[model samples]
Every structure is written in C-alpha cells, then in structure tokens.
Target chain A: MKKPEPVGAVKHRRDTVLSAIVSQIPYIRFLGVSFDRHGDELTATMAYHPDLIGNPMLPALHGGATASFLEITAIVGLTWASLWEDMEAGNIDVGTVQQGALLLPKTIDFTVDYLRAGLPRDAYARAVLNRSGRRYASVHVEGWQDNRQRLFAQATGHFLMPPRDAKH
Target chain B: MEDLADGMAVISMPYDEALIGDPVTKVIHGGAVSALMDTAGGAAVMAHPRAGVGTATLDLRIDYMRSATPGQRITATATCYHVTRSVAFVRATACDEDGDLPVATATGAFTVIPGKSKT
Candidate 1:
C-alpha cells in the first residue's frame, strides 16, 4: 500500500474539495460567501451588493440574506470541524476527508433573531460549534457589519450528521 | 387601480440556477427558501389592516420539511396571524407542485411601525 499522506496534505485537498462544493451552491455563489482562516477560527464574509436589499426605504440588507449567510457559515464550520475531529481521532479512513465534506449535513432546524437592520455594507459572520453529538450537531452563529461590537443578527442551527461509525 | 385583500400575500419563484444549492443534485438552496419566506412575510405585513408605514423582521424560525423539487416553481403564501401595538405575527408555507405537502414552513415576528417616523 502507498504511504498515507500527512494530515496537512489531506487538509489542503479537503479544502479544495469543500471550496468547490461551496462555490457550486447557487445562493452562496450569488451572495459571494468567502472563507478565511485567522489563527484557528474561520470567518465567512459576504460582500454588500444592491441586489441584497429587501427594504428600499432603509436600504438594508434583506433579513433573509443575513439569515442565510449565518446559516451557511454555521453549516460550513460544522463540516470542517467534524472532518478535522474525525481525522484527529483516526476514525476517518485515509483519503476520505474530501468525500466527507462533500456530503453536506442535512439541516434539521434553523432559528434567527434579527437584532438590527443590516446596513448596505460588507457583512461578516462567525460560527461556533456548541455541541457535536453522535447523530446531531448544534451551532451558534453571529453576524456583524462595519463594527464587530454591534451585531446585526444571531442564529442557532441544528444539523443531522451520520453516526460516528457510519460510512461517509 | 385595484385593491388587494388584507393580510395575505403570495410570492412565487422559479427554480433557476441561481437558487440551486447542489448542481449535481439540482436541489434548491435552503437559504433561497428562507429568503422567499422572509419576503413573503414582509409582503403580508404590507397588506395587513394594521400595517405600519414600514416593518422589519424581528425573528424567524424555519423548518425544512423537504428539498424543493428541481425545475419547479416554488411559491410561498403568507398570512398575518395577529397584529398588536408593536408586533405582527406571520406564518408562511412554501410548496412546489407536489400536492399539499410543503417544502418548508416558517413563522416569524415583524416589528410594526404603527406610523411613519418623523426622523
């Protein structure tokens, strides 16, 4: 058997596959959700555009647009975290991380609280995995624009994942 | 000049490439569904008897009952359930051509600005 690639190498491959999957998502593509890593956390950024306005009066970002951005961020964060955790535990078979990320988790539920109207500007969101159980994962996500101290929205979502032992 | 019914609105969106979440599966993205529901909810608020000059979404909860079928128009019908001094409650369901089952359902609260703000 060929030698297994290093975890770093596997991660690079996984990122490429995952990014491609995310890009193919039409809404994500239209909204321009981009991912970046700072230290150890991932941040999702959405560029402001005129098409995202729902209320022409305040010229605010559509509530659905904000909610969707947070939701996508949380889902993507969970996917990466799950893959990495599985790999670190040696539970993930070699050459399967990419496939794992491709199999997007099914969203079980989503809730969003619009704290304030999102202005017409670039928006950012960060998601934290609160709990990763055997069959389900929960994530909390917050979105902000212009100033990080003032959040535009907050959301929580649950997604269905396969059991730890199940094949990807 | 035509008059529309009160507290009721319907929004229809076709399944296009821009709404697809998975190109391979050709399924509509959940976010697009949420946007559709939100827009419909806002429209209902606009048509309400007690509609304020303006409104904003306060909270929304969405349940994805199923993925919308590929290449089918998805429509959301929203009705304002109640309106108080400061809030309006709206519930909506999105469905494709597949009978009575809904692709998704959402319940949301909207902030009703009783009158136009002078600011």
Candidate 2:
C-alpha cells in the first residue's frame, strides 16, 4: 500500500529529474544556466557574458544563443516529465539511477523566430509541453529579457525518445 | 568565417567537453550545432555577391539527423541561395570531419542591410 506523497516529496523528486538531465549537458553549464522551480514550474536563467555577445554594435546577446537557450529549456522540461512518469510507474528510482540511466532526448526538428534583438543581459526562458506520446514530444518555448512581457524569441520543437536500451 | 571556394562561408567548432550534451555518451548538444549553423548562415549573407552589408537572423530552422561524432571538428558551411532587396535566403549544413553525411541541415532568412554603392 503506497502512502500519499507529500508536496515536498514530489518537489524533491522533480528536482532530481531536472538535475539528472541538466547535469549531462555541457553547453548548459558553459552558458551559465541556473534553474528555478516553483510549484512544478521550471524556468531557466542564462547569465550574460562577453563571449555570448554576437552584435558588438548593440552589445546584444546572440540571437543564436537565445534560440538555443529556449530550445534547451523545452528539452529539459520534457525530459523531466518523462522521468517523472518513469518514477510513478515504478520503473526507476530517481535516487539510485546511474548517469546513463536515461538516454539523451534527440531533437527531431526545431524552429526559432527572433522577435527582437537579445540585449546584453540575463535572459529567461520557459517551455510548455504541448503533447507527449510514447516516442515523441512536442514543446513550445519562449525567451524574454528584463521584462517578461516582451519576448525575444519563440520556438517550437519536436524531440524523439529512443528506447532505454537502444543506442542513439 | 573562413572563406571557402564557390562563395561559401565556413565556421569550424572544435570538439570540447563544454559542448557535450550527454557526459556518458559525449554527444554534442543540438544547441551548439544550431549556433554554429546560425553563425554560418549570417556569414553567408555577409559573403554574398553584394558584400559589406550587415544582416540579422529572422528565422532559422534546423533538422537534426544524427549526433555529431565526439572528438571531431564540427564544420558548418552556408550558401546564400537567394537575395532580395530586404531579405536573403541561406542554407547551411553542419557535419563532422568525415563529412559523408550532414549531422544537421538548416535553412534561414536574414534581414539585409543596404551597403554604400561600390561605384
């Protein structure tokens, strides 16, 4: 008989899922991405650095960087959801999982629209999972700068999830 | 961007630990590949027949077929396929050293900046 899971336990489980995916991505660390979780929602913050600037005239954050950031957010969100599902089904234990317990999600296709120049400052992104199936997941993501109301980019992507034992 | 023959611009990204998407598999992140392709697309606009014009990415779409082999030089080449008064269409491919098949293919449009008359 499984007992009712408390809110804290659920949050902790989600954090484990998020970290498991985030820790594997070297580019995420290179860009200084920090994650924040509130009630089940995850948002990523990218710290500004000189190496990320593309347009020296405007001293703006590279558009490519903005797109990548938002895309990563989407992938992370979906990976978290997938892991959580695995936990609920009693398939895997989040605590004792090894580094390669889950295969990295592969991007099938991605589209990015640059709404405006990414200014030289911290950028924030959040991904909304649109749909998830056995083999594929679709996500919509957006990125904003200082003001959340103003968007810097919008992206939509599809990711392919291979079987656990299959090689990507 | 390094100039290649036939009006192509190429950008090379070294394989480094900082680019790995999966530490266990050592796969390069899709974002890094996207960035490299985007940069190549913008460079293609700069190397267009009507050079000396600044351009910004309007939209970029990438289709990833496979993971870039780890510990190999990733290179992206961009070619400007079409040009209009206000927009330039570019296509790019990112591949590893083997170069038999592209890891990803990208198509993008860029806003063209007017340059001073060469006359």
List the DockQ of the predictions in order. 0.62, 0.74
On DockQ, the leading prediction is 2
Per-candidate Cα lDDT values, in order, are 0.81, 0.81
Estimate, for each residue in A62-140, the C-alpha lDDT of model 2 and write its tens digit. 7678777987898778777666656655566665454555676789989999988888889999989899887888899
Tens-digit lDDT string for candidate 2 (B1-119): 56654336899999999988767679888899999998888887877766444678899999998889999989999998887767888899999998999999999988877663121
Residue pairs with colliding backbones in model 1 are none
Docking class of 2: medium
* Candidate 1 chain A weakest lDDT stretch, 10 residues: A93-102
Q: Which 10-residue span in candidate 2 chain A carries the lowest summed lDDT? A: A93-102
| TM-score computed on alpha carbons, candidate 1 | 0.87
- Candidate 2: which stretches are off by over 4 Å? A1-7, A88-91, A164-168, B4-7, B115-119
